[model samples]
Target: MIERRLFEFHFANGDKNGVYHAVYAYRNPDGGFGHGMEPDTASPESQPLFSIMALETLDEVGYLTKEIILNDFMPYFQSVTTEKGGIPWMFRPKSDYPCEGHFKTVKEWAALSTTAPLLGILEKYEIDIPWMKKAEQFVWSEFERIKDKHVFCYLCVPRWLTFLKYTKNQDKAEETINNLKKWILVDGIVCKDKADEGWGLYGKPHSLNYATSPESILHSLFNKETITSDLKELVNKQKDDGRWDTWYGISEGTKLEWAGIQTLWALKVLNNYGEIEK
Candidate 1:
């Protein structure tokens, strides 16, 4: 239902309300979202990861309003937030529904990987609420702590990039991007060649996965040839059934759900780079 609505919204001149309705079905009474909205876990309990997916969907459909941010999202985040004012990647699932083992093993501590992206979403929408300041503080501290590290987690790089992309502190953001460049493609943080593997959920992080759009600050890290090749690689990955597949999922249901999500993502990326008509 969600995937079909997303397809229609993007490609078939469909109504955004349909997408909103389907996504809202996952909203918990606590104002957070769950029930496997992310596809990697089927836990019905409200989780930070699921809420991130939910917010991303809402943002895509232009349904993320200031009211939604202040009333629905902030309260839920406050309830789950750590003392450091950041949310954990996952909370221990209260229900026994299927969940990946890695998600089950997470400790209830603040994680920049999850928190930074949420902040990025808020930044992108220019939505400022009281809770955002604390999140920003925590994310900045994490960035400072990790800047000198020899390597970075592949997953965190894009989230951090998203935060930097929309962050108000352009000077600091530029400095951080420059500092991180040495480790980005050089330390194998991002995949420059097509053969690099095992560095991401499905494979190594493609150049497109980092830069996302031509205007993104991360685009400076890749050459024209690299982006062009990665674009071709992305286009070739689509299956005969007109959907993209995910290599990481704990269940058959999860795989199918992720396929739909990935298909939507692929279409958006192609359209962003003008590989296809929007």
Candidate 2:
């Protein structure tokens, strides 16, 4: 059960029809139980950012069984779909071109969504396994092209583990485990400050544009997992107040929603280490 304070945005104004008079765009059309706030740009919900962030939350807080979905999330993606069904970027759709998300094919699309992660952590949650062979084949093949980018972050772990788990590819799993360290900002994550004036595959971080890139994302990625003393140092920095400002600025505006999102994201890493959940 979620605290009412955190959940009222969806239930507070809901009608007898089960629809909330308020609009949470990422929500199912009926305005049923879901994880995001209103999706109207004028409101705090402009970015469909919460869609994945929410899935990540549900991923952590043991709520995905009830929240998260393709139907509910697809409208946002549908706005961007180019063909029968394809998601270029998980956030920006094909229509937002130049501003569109990357990964041109449907296989690429699944990599961007929780589809990969959910499947990876499935057995951990006691979920089913179907068509795993095809799923594993697709993700590993695609990672070779985008491993340097955040796109890789979404699927690398899952794909690597998939090969190890289903295909019994120990050699490949070892390779993935080796590279997993590099993916972590072990130090920090780097993102450009603003949207580029011209088009590119993805966007960059805002604050650290001038000083020189530091390790924010990787550091954050490993923040909850103390496999190394460096990660323990970073996670320990969480304020007594129970928050860590992705302060280096990789997630500036996102700080507003960072508390819940990062808290849960951090927990995932920690859980990976067999540490007890806080």
Candidate 3:
């Protein structure tokens, strides 16, 4: 679809300005992203996870400027961060912003889902804020506490892996990798529905449930052969409208945002594998 073309153009032309603007359009005044960049959290208020998405999107397009990080982004994140140095997944919503599901502001806790990548992002820029140092300690402590792979928090594995990989924390990295291998490789990705998961709206967590092939980020942990079937399934599951679908329980607007992100991720994997021409 048009989003695919935009994604293709993003990588092919080496122009990130358009992509940056598209993503930036969702940025809240607080310097964090909102207005449904994450789709699941439609709250216009600054949410930590959506902020991570914003930074990652900027990083992906090479538009992660110091201005964005130092002046605009960090302040907002810093303000919302808890005393323990961990960021809650979401915060209180703006009066006009409608939130649902996991998007609502509840008990705030530093989540691996948010902190790991936020740490990685900070490290990438060499921006050593106080929270960064504290976050490292918190992450390692969390790692020590988590003795096994958590299925409900399965969506967060890659981000934690990325954090470990970036920090070169071999011990935690190996443990996480092994845990993921046991869960996904040995046990298998679990979802509510097994029969019709290929359509994109299935509740079951397949290899492609969150993004592209599992091997995209976890290549060191898994070979192409292991996830090749799922990768191929991604290509086969493309809807006639040119967008790959996702689960339908979320608001349609949120679903569309996720579809855009997931579709771009899928294209990236296919392009990397030479399955699709650039």
Candidate 4:
């Protein structure tokens, strides 16, 4: 019932209050959220990665107000952002906090995964702060720098596309998307050895389609047939208990949070595709 209520309030009723209560439990006192909201990292300390999740959730619920963005969230982000204006992948608390084994951040480096979604959140809320302009620069530069490289990041693609989708710079957005397509499709990252292989964009759990709901820009990279197939896969993965299982092995408490998050994502994808009654 709790999971149903959470999904229905978020997907059908547009209930900001319900979503807020669900999200706020993880918020830290310092205005960022980190208390294992990600399930991989169990620290109450504010993390850029988890903060992006919280902000994106708020935006999804239409609760990302200017006041909250500028006053509450931006300050913590400003404190953590690199001199180059890009936020790090994470900033773990110095104090003793619960952390999974092998927990680490990029440490003094900007990460596209964290920075792009944060940019998307700012764009969604229409907050044109000065830092955003700098972040925009970083996103493009990083895209160009890594586009031709042998490496690719499936997790960051959706987030980067989200930022591009709402970006005011249409020309730049188009250019960046073109580059991404080359890296993902033309360069063989989408289906490297075979479909569903390691790091191939679509096959993995929480892949591009799973992360990016109502995926429009990526239609070229992932065809309608593929999208439909992936959608069916998502449906098939739902458990008998009505919650989708997470791929991670974590503590029981964090496991519950991760399952809830994954369930929310699955419902969002279903609701986006007309599978849920609006």
Candidate 5:
């Protein structure tokens, strides 16, 4: 339903409100999202990661208004934030619906992976609220701590890059980018080769995942030849059934759900690079 609405909005001249209504079904009373909006977790309880998915959807349709952020999302974020002003990847779900084993457990630490992306999304929309200030502090502090570190997770690379992209401090962001560049494709932060297992899977962040659009700051990290090759590979990844496949092993139901979302994402990325026909 969500993918259908998104397809309509993007390709079939459908009303953006349709997308909103479909996504709103996932919203909890707490203003955060759950109920399998993220597909990995069927838990009805609100989660920070699910909220990121919600915010991304809202932003895609230009429905992420300041009012919504303040009245809905901010309150939920405030409620779950850790002492370090960052949210956890997941909280223990109140109701036990089907969820991945990792998400089923409580994540006690404040995670930069989730928090940076949230901050980056807010920064992308240029929306300001008091809660963001604290999040910004936490994200920046983490960035500083990890700048010199050799081992950084692939999942966190794009999230941190997104934060750096829209951050107010261009000088520091650029420096951080330069510092991190040495480790990006070098230290397994990005899967440069297609032969790598789970190369484009959920956990493996790749060059295209980092750059996304041609206009992205991360685009500078890869040369035109590399980008072109990646784009061609991306185009060829489409299956005969008109969907992309996720290498991550999941249930059939979850796989179908992910296929829809992945198809939507592929179209968007292709459109961004002028690969889509009018």
Candidate 6:
């Protein structure tokens, strides 16, 4: 099944010989950062900016390589990361170079879930890079110092999952996730009164971005097999694509990246406990 899916993404759209397999839109070699898809795209920035979740999908699909996966992917990734002293949250393809700390905002859902997704991928890829240590330390240190802040909810959730996935520090992982649970109001819902809730590192997703997001931390908990039955409503929200939305917006629609992080989280939760919608 995985193999068939792999061919679909890696070769299905290409010629039978698979001559130009590196058609990833974000990597259009010219695709400016627009809609995560570029047509005749080119920019002076030359940075292949990608969401961490997006990279995970590619690697999980077994398509990442030195050629397609830029050696500078991490550098560009770090350019937006704090450890690299980045002020740019994202880059504009129109610019000559990626802006350090340039992003004006980290979207609500992304604010909560993006880092851990990157951390997981970085941990897996760091074996080859080693230079990513600085960014790792920077994020880890900040995570430890201000953990109690509601905004720290985003960091801790994915960080816990990253550790669970990459490190053998089961105790630490469990502890982090447990502590993060304090902010969740499971029996109720976040309201307009606390709408300014900074659940993510930055404020976001209106109500869904914070400690309250039933879907946000649910995956991390499921990965550890620590919380079962509490995630039915979350899991049932998965799309038919064997993945869940990265962030859903019915008005503008959603950008359901359908990445592996979601799939892994859903699978672990459902497999251990039972499918939700069944």
User: In model 1, which residue pairs have backbone atoms overlapping below 3 Å?
Assistant: none
lDDT of 6 by residue, 18-55 (tens): 22233243443343223332111223343333444335
The TM-scores of all predictions, comma-separated, are 0.88, 0.43, 0.81, 0.81, 0.88, 0.48
Q: So what's the TM-score on candidate 6? A: 0.48
Predicted structure 6: clash tally: 12
Judging by lDDT against the true structure, name the best candidate: 1
lDDT of 4: 0.70
Error of 1 at 147 (Å): 3.3
- Model 5 residue runs over 4 Å out of place are 121-128, 147-155, 195-197
Per-residue lDDT tens digits of candidate 3, residues 1-278? 32443575656674667777777788877788777665555556667877887777778767786667888778877887776677777665655566664545466777666787878777777677676888888787776676454543545766776686677567767776576666555443544233575333433555554334434555544455545766677688788998876675367776777778667766776776667864
lDDT of each: 0.79, 0.37, 0.66, 0.70, 0.78, 0.41
Candidate 2 local accuracy as lDDT? Answer: 0.37
| Best-to-worst ranking by lDDT | 1, 5, 4, 3, 6, 2
Candidate 4: segments with Cα more than 4 A from true spot:
1-6, 11-14, 148-154, 186-188, 191-215
Worst 10 residues of 5 by lDDT: 147-156
Instruction: Give the range of the ten consecutive residues with the poorest summed lDDT in model 3.
Output: 185-194
lDDT per residue as tens, model 1, 166-244 = 8898898888888777666675556555554332244466677767789876788889998898888888777899987
What TM value does model 4 have? 0.81
- Tell me model 5's lDDT, rounded to 2 decimals: 0.78
Candidate 6 residue runs with Cα over 4 Å from true position: 1-23, 28-34, 37-49, 65-72, 78-88, 91-116, 125-128, 148-156, 168-174, 185-278
Question: What is the lDDT, from 0 to 100, of the residue 250 in candidate 5?
Answer: 54
Global fold similarity of model 3 (TM-score): 0.81
